[model samples]
Target chain A: MADGLRVGVVGATGQVGAVMRKLLAEREFPIAELRYFASARSAGSKLPWRDTEITIEDASTADPSGLDIALFSAGGSTSKAQAPRFAAAGVTVIDNSSAFRMDPDVPLVVSEVNPEAVKEARKGIIANPNCTTIAAMPVLKPLHDEAGLVRLVASTYQAVSGSGLAGVDELAGQVRAAAEHASLLTHDGAAIDFPKPEKYVRPIAFNVLPMAGSIVDDGEFETDEEKKFRNESRKILSIPGLAVSCTCVRVPVFSGHSVSVNAEFERPLSVERATELLTHAPGVELSEEPTPLQAAGNDPSYVGRIRVDPGVEGGRGLALFLSNDNLRKGAALNAIQIAELVAQQL
Target chain B: MADGLRVGVVGATGQVGAVMRKLLAEREFPIAELRYFASARSAGSKLPWRDTEITIEDASTADPSGLDIALFSAGGSTSKAQAPRFAAAGVTVIDNSSAFRMDPDVPLVVSEVNPEAVKEARKGIIANPNCTTIAAMPVLKPLHDEAGLVRLVASTYQAVSGSGLAGVDELAGQVRAAAEHASLLTHDGAAIDFPKPEKYVRPIAFNVLPMAGSIVDDGEFETDEEKKFRNESRKILSIPGLAVSCTCVRVPVFSGHSVSVNAEFERPLSVERATELLTHAPGVELSEEPTPLQAAGNDPSYVGRIRVDPGVEGGRGLALFLSNDNLRKGAALNAIQIAELVAQQL
Candidate 1:
C-alpha cells in the first residue's frame, strides 16, 4: 500500500456504500486516508475502516481539497450537484449515479471492457454504467468481438437489493408475513396478509414485478431502467446502432441480477464458439445453470445455458443466460475497479 | 344448468386436481355426477365437490363406464396409462400431462384459442397444453392472427406452484427459515440456512431458478420446459413453422406464471394495434404492469407493457409481458374450459 491515495466515500451508509467500503478493503485497494460522507441526517455518524474510525460528513458541505479520489454512490441528484464541485476541487469523481453517465464529457467505463476509455474523462469524472449494463459488458464484449453483434432482447430477473435498502426490507418483511401464512398463500395469493408495499408499486415478496423502474413518462413507453440498458450498453460497447428491447423485472432474489439475452449478429455464431469466448473472458465465469444464489457475493458474472437462437435467420442469433452479484460486480466492485485503474495513473 | 355431464377428475388429490375440482364447482360446469380419482395412496380420501363428499377412486383400476368426461391432472405416466383406458371406455379425456400433447392423434387445445379443434379429438383425448403455453395462447392467438407470427423468444417467471405441492412446501419452508435469519440472507445469500432442496435444484424461497425442467438429453441443451414452450407454442398456435427460443425460470411466487415475450411477425404490428387486439381478446386482461400477485387465482392471462421491438426489421417485431395463474389458466382452468366445450358438444 505504498502509493495509497486519500479517498472519500460519499453516501457511506447506504446499501451499495457498505459494499463499496468492504470491496475497498477486500481488494486491498491502496488507501492512505479515508473519509466518509452521507446526508445531513447521517452526518457525524462513525464508520470503521480497518484500524481506525472515520466521522461522516454531510456530502453537501464536505470539503474536497485533499482527496485524490471520491466515489459517489449516493443518488443521481447528489452526483448531479456535488460531482462537478469535487472535480473543481481537483478530486477525480467516479460517480455511481446516472447523472454523469450519459454526459458527453464523462467516460462511462466498465473496467474490463473499456478501461482505456477512462483516459478520456475530460471532466475529471467517470461514470459507472448501470448494474444491469455492467453485468452484460464482460459477457457481450467478448461475443461482439467474435460476431458483429447487431440486436439484443434482454429480460432481466433483478434482485430487491437493486432498489436499495428499502427494497430489501420490504422483501424481508413480506417474506416473513407470507411464510407465517404459508398455508394461506399456497392456495390463494390474496390471502397472504402482505404488508402494504412502501418501496415498490406491488409486493416484492414471492412476486415478480414486470415493472422494475418507474415508468418513464416518455412516449417510448420504456422504464427508466429499460432505457438505461439501451443507452448504457450502446455507450459501453461503443455500438451506437445496436438495437435492444429489454424488459426489466424485479424478482425476490436478494443480490444477484440475471439476464436472459438473445443476441442477433451480422454473422453466424455457434454455441461452441460463444462458450469458448465466455470461458476465457475476463470478469465472467461460465456455469451450467447460473442463478442468483450462485452469483451472490461472487465477483464474476456467471454465464451459462448457451444455445443457438433459432429465431434469428441462418443461425445468426445466440441465446444465453448470465448472473452477477448486483452489489459487487454490478455496482461497488466495478466502481472500485475503475478507481483502481485511476489509482495506478496517479 | 342444462346438459349436466358426469365428470371424473383423475389425480383429484394433487395440486392441480384440487384446482380442477374447485373450478368445476365455481364455474358450475353442469355436473350431474362428480367423481374423484387418484393414485392408490389417495384412493380412499374424500373431497367435497359441492354439497356432498366424493371418495377418490384408484385411477389405475377405477371403472370409467359411466363417466362422460375425465380431467387428468396427474403426472405424465398416470395420464399415459389411464387416459387410453378411459378414452377406450367412451369417456373423453382432457389430459393435462405431457404424455399425449405431441401425439398427432391428440388434439392439444387451449379452449379460447382453438375451441374448434375440440371437434377433432378422434382419439377421445383432448390434450391441454403446458401451463406456460396456455398463458401465451390467448395473448398470441390475436397477434398471430393479425400479423402472422413467425418467431418467438420467451423468458418465463414461473411460480413454484407449477412444480406441485412439494415445490410450494419447499419455498414455504425456505421462506420461514430465511425470515428467521433475515439479516443473514439480506447481506449474504450463502449465509442463510436454506433447507436441502428436494423438489428444485436449488433453494427457491427468495431466489429464481433458471432451470425449470430437467434438461433433456436431446443435445439441444434445453430443459423439458423449454422444449414444451417451443413445441406446444408451435402446435397450439398451429404455426408449425414458428421458431421459438425460450428460457423458463421458476420464481418464488406461490402462484401465477409470468412471461416476457418478444415476437416477430411477417407483417408490421404496432404497439397500439397489439394493445387494441389484446384489449378485447378472450382469456386475456390487459394490465399496465402485469405481475404474478395480481394474476394469481385469476383466470385471464394478464397482459401489459406492449412495446415495439426494434430488434426485428421493417417494424415487424413486438415485445410484451404477461402473467397468468399457473394453477388455473395454466393447468386446471383450461382443462375445465375444454371439458365445458366437450360438454356443450355432448
Candidate 2:
C-alpha cells in the first residue's frame, strides 16, 4: 500500500467523475497508479490524465484487487452491486451514491464537519453525503456547535448538473432552441416548441422545477432529494431529534447550488454573532451578497444575507443564504478529501 | 362615473403597467375612458386600447380630475408623490409599489385573502402586496381558513421581470454571450465574458442570486423584499402576531415567481385535506408538479408538491411549492381585481 496510493475512479466518464479526476490532479492527491472504470458503454473509452490516456474498464466486472482506495461516483444501483466487492477486496471505497448513506455500518462523512466519524466505517465503505446536504454541512457545523441546532428549513436552487450530464444537455439544448425561437420567453407555456423533456418532468430552460428528484411513493410524499436532506442531515449532524423540512427546487444554473436556510437553535444567537462565527468557520466564506456564478469555481460555501428569524422565539433562530459549487465541494472534492483523510490513517 | 368607469394607468410603459392594460382589456372590465400616465420621458407616447390611441400624460403635473381609478405601477418615489394628489381628486388609487403597502391609511389588499379589507381604504388609496407575497396569498388563504396559521417560513425564487425591462435585457444579453462561447458552460466561471451586470449585483444568467432586493439598512439586515413579505403578510392575513421569516432569491426565469412555503397552523391538517382545500381555493390551481414556465402566462397560482412537514408537531404544518406569473397575477391582475371590487361600490 506504500507506493503512494493505488486509486480507482468508478463512473469516470460522468460529470462528477470528470470533476473527481480534475480535483484529484488540482489538489495534488498522492496517487501512484490511477485506474478508471465506467459502465459497459464507456468501457473502452480513454480519458486524459496528466498527459496520458487511461482506458476505462467496465465497472460491472472488474478486478478490485491491489487498489488502496476507490472513489465511486456511479449511480446508486451500480454502487449497491459493486461497492461491497471492492470493500471485500481490501479496497476502502468512498461512495458518492445514496445507496449506503443511511446504512448503520457505513459512515457518511463530510471531511470538515465530522472527520472523526470516518473511523466508524465497519463496512470499509464511507458514504458521501448528498450534494445538497454536503454543501450545507460546513455552514451548519459551526452554527450547530454554538447554539445546538434543533431545526432546519431549507429551500434549494440546485443546478442542472446535479441531475447528470443528461440534465446539462437537456438545459443547453432547450436554451439553444428557445434562443432561436425567442417566443418562449414572451408567450405562454406552449407557445414555443421545446424538445420533449426526457430527463426532467418539465422544461428546464428558463424555469424553476419545484420537485428535483422523483417523488418517493411512500405516504410521506417527499422526493428522494427532499428525504435525503432530512435523513442525511440527521445522520451527519448526529442529532437524532433535529427536525428538518426541505423543499428541493431545481433552477437553470449549470454548476452551483444555492440554499436559503432558516436554522433554529436551542440557545439564543444573534445575527452579528452568527456572522462572526461564520467568518472564521472552515470551508465557509462570508460575503455581502453570494451568488452561484461566484461560487461555480470556488470551494468554500459563500454565505451571506444573515438576519434574525422572527419565527423562532426570542432570537434563537438565524436565517442565512449560501451558494456552493455542486460538483466540487458538494461531490467530487469532498470524496477526494475524505480519501485523503483515510490516507493519513493508512 | 355613470357609464362604465374611467381608468388611468400610471407608468404605462413599465412591465407590470403593460400587463395591467392587457388584463383590463382581456377581462373586459367596464371602461368608458382609458388614460395613460408616465414621467416626462414617456409623457407623449401613444398607447392603444381597442380602437383608440391614448396619449400618456405626465403623472406629476397632470390634473387627476374625472378619473374613477388610477393604477400606479411606477417606482416608489413617483407613487409617493402622485398617489395623494389623485386621492385628493376623489380618484381611487391602487398603487403597485411598496410606497403605500405599509401605510395603515392605505389598505393592502390581495383580493382573495382580504377582499373585505378593501373597504377600509381611509386615504382613498389601496395597496397591492409585493409580487412574492401576492403569489402566496391564494395558496395560503384556504389553509389558514381551515386551520389557524400561526407561523410561516418562505423562500422565494423570484424572476427578473420583477426587476423590470433592464433585468430582462441583462439576462438576455448574458445568455447570448455565454452561448457564443460554449466554453463558458464546459469550463470554470471565469471562462465566459458576461456583459457587465447593470441591473443586479451579480450575474443572473445561469446563476441564482440569494439576495433579491438590496438590504434596507434598517439595522435588521433584511432586504426590502424580505421585509415586505413580513409586513404585508401580517396586514393581508389579519394576523398581527403571526410569526414570519422569509428569504427572497432572484432566479433567471423571465416571468414566474415561485415560493416554497412551510406553514404551521394551530390545528392539524393532512396532505389530503390541504390538497382538497387548495383544489377549490380561489385564484389557486392544484397541479402535479408545478414549474415556473407553466405559470408564466397564467392567472392562477399553480400549487403542488404538498407534503407533511415531519419537523412540525402533530402534522400541524404543511410544506408546499407554488408558481405564479409575477407580472400577471402577482401585480396587474390583483390590482385589476381590486378595481373590479371597487367598481361594485362605484
Candidate 3:
C-alpha cells in the first residue's frame, strides 16, 4: 500500500459501476483505500470490495476529499453537478457520462487510441467516449495513421445493456414472454403481444430498433447516440473537420456493441495493409466473423469482415466490422486504464 | 377467365413458396390455372390453393407445356437447370434465385423501381433482386431521381428467414433453449450452451452475426449476399457505374430486412424533400423510426430516420434507414407483381 492512491467509485450501485468495481479488482489496481458512492436510496448499503464490505456513501453529501481519483458512472445530470466539485477537491474525475465530453478543457479519451490526450486534461477531468464510439476507436486508429482518414459512415448494432439495467430487464422480460410464440413471431412479428416497452420505444426482444436514443431536436432527426459517435470520434482522433454519418440501432443482445464502418481516407489503403495493421494493433483482435456474443465478456475489440469499399476511388476507402464489450472496454475498463495512467503521474 | 393466364409456381413447398401461394389468393392474380412444382422429395405433397388441393410435381421432371408464366423460387442450381427448360416451352420465367440476376439478357427487376426493365428479359427470365437488395430499391429509386445518386454505403440488419426455413428453426431452437439463461446471457453471452448453429456460423439468439452469407472467393472478402446487394441495386436502378459498399449482417429477427444507408449524389438533396419523395413513392411507407418487426408481413418498405449526411459536401449526401418484409416485397410479392404485369401484357 506504500505508493497506492485512494479511489472513489461514484454511482457504485449501477450496472456500469458494478463492472467498474469488478475490473478494479481484476486488474489489481493499486488502491490503498476504496470508497463507494451512490444515490440516497442506495446509500449506507454494503458492497463487497475484495475480502471486506464497503459502505456506500451518498454522492450528493459525501466528502470526496482525500481521494486521488473518482470514476463517475452516474447519469449526465449527476456528473454535471458533481464532477466539477470533485475536480475542485484535487481529485481527477474520470467521467463515463456525456456531461463533459464535448468540453474543450476535458479530453475525451479511448485509452488505447488517445492515451496521450490524458495529459491534456486541463480541467482534471477525463471523459470516456460513448460505448459505440469506443468500440471503433481502437480499430480505426491504426487505419487512420496509415491513411489520412477524411470521412466515415457508421451503422451500429448496439446491445440493450448500453441503456443500463432497465434495458436488460426490458429485453429479458420480452424474450421470456414472447419465446413461446416463435411460430407467430417467425411469420408476423407484430402479432405477438410483448410486454409494454418502457426503456425503448419498441420491444427489444427478437427485434432491431433503428432508433437507439432519443432524437435530438436539432432539425437533423439524428439520435443523440449518433451525434455522440461523430463528435467523439472527431475529438479523440484529433481531426476536428472529419466528415461522419452514423445511424445508431439497438439490438436484443445484452452486451457488446458492433459497428459497420465505411471509411474513406485521403491516401489509398489496401485491404491487406489494413488487416496487417489491425492484427498487431493494441487492444484489437482480428476475428473471422465478429459478433456481439463473442465480444460480450472480452476486452479487445474483435474486428473482421475487412474489405475494400468499392464506393471510394483509388482504394482510398475500406469497410470493416467490429465488436467490443460495451461495459468493459467501452466504459469501466477504459476508465480504470486512464486511472492507471493518472496514478503514474501522481 | 378468358383473359387469365396459366401459371406454374416452382419451389412451391418452401418458405417463400408458402408466402407466394397465400399472396396469389390474397392479391387475386388473373390465373386461369395454377400448377405447383418442388423437389422430388416434396413432389407428391398436396398444397392448398384457393378452394382445392394441388399436387406438387417434381420440378426436375415437370412438363411445362401448358404454363404461360413460371415463378421460380427454387435454389440457384434448380433454376439454372430448369428455368431455361420452362422458358423453352414458351413460359416467361420470373426467377427469385440468383442464377440469372447478373446475366446480360435477364433483366433484374424491382417492381416499383424499374418495372420497364421487365420488357428486356430477352432470355424469357425476369430475375427478382435479392431480398436484402429489394428492400432498398424503392427507397433509393425516388432519391436517385431527385438527386443523381452516385455512391452508397449500406449496412444491413437482415433477418434469419432470408436463409430459408432452416434459419428460422435455428433461431427458434436457440432462443427456446437459452431463454431460461437470460441472467447468464445478459452478463456473459458466451456462457450459455446455445444449440449448435446450422444456418449461420454463430448463435443467432441474442446475437448479431456480421457475416450473413457464405463469403465469395472473389478476393474481396465480400459475402455473396453483400455482392448481390451491390450488383442487384445497380441493375434494378440502371446505374451501371454506381459505387456501392454493403455489409450484410444477420440478426436474430425471424423476418424483415433493414438497411441503414448513407448515399452521396450528384446534386444536393434536403431531408424534407427526400421525405416527401419517399412518402409518395410506390411500394414505400414512411415511419418515424422503422423496425424490422413493423415491416414483417407488410407490403411496403417502411423508411424513416431521414437526415442529411454531414460527411458529403454541399448537402450532396443523405442518410436514411429503411425496413421491409424480406418475404413479401423482397421475394414473393415482387415476383407475383411481375407475373401480374406479364398477365396484363398478355
lDDT, candidate 1, B1-346, per-residue tens: 3658888999999899988888988987898888999989988889996778988899999899989999998899999899999999999999999999999989999999989999999899999999999999999999999999999999999988888888888887787777777576574575676879989878887677888998899878899999999999899988999999999989888888999999999999999999999989999999999998899878999999898898888989999999999899999999999998998888
Best by DockQ: 3
Which regions of candidate 1 deviate over 4 angstroms?
B1-3
Candidate 3's residue-wise lDDT over B319-338, tens digit each?
A: 99999999999999999998
lDDT by residue (A1-346, candidate 1, tens digit) is 3669999999999999999999999998888889999999999989999878899999999898999999999999999999999999999999999998999889999999999998988999999999999988999998999998899999999998899988888887777776666575564675666768999988877788888998898777889999999999999989999999999999988889999999999988999999999989999999998988899989999999998888888889998999999999999999999999999888
DockQ (C-alpha based) per candidate is 0.78, 0.67, 0.80
Assess candidate 3 and give its lDDT. Answer: 0.91
User: What TM-score does chain B get in every candidate?
Assistant: 0.98, 0.98, 0.98
Better of 2 and 3 by DockQ: 3
| Superposed Cα RMSD, model 1 | 1.3
For candidate 2, the per-residue lDDT at A235 reads: 94
In model 1, state the lDDT of residue B281.
95
Query: Deviation in angstroms for A52 in model 3?
Result: 1.0
| TM-scores, one per candidate | 0.98, 0.97, 0.98
Each model's backbone clash number: 0, 0, 0
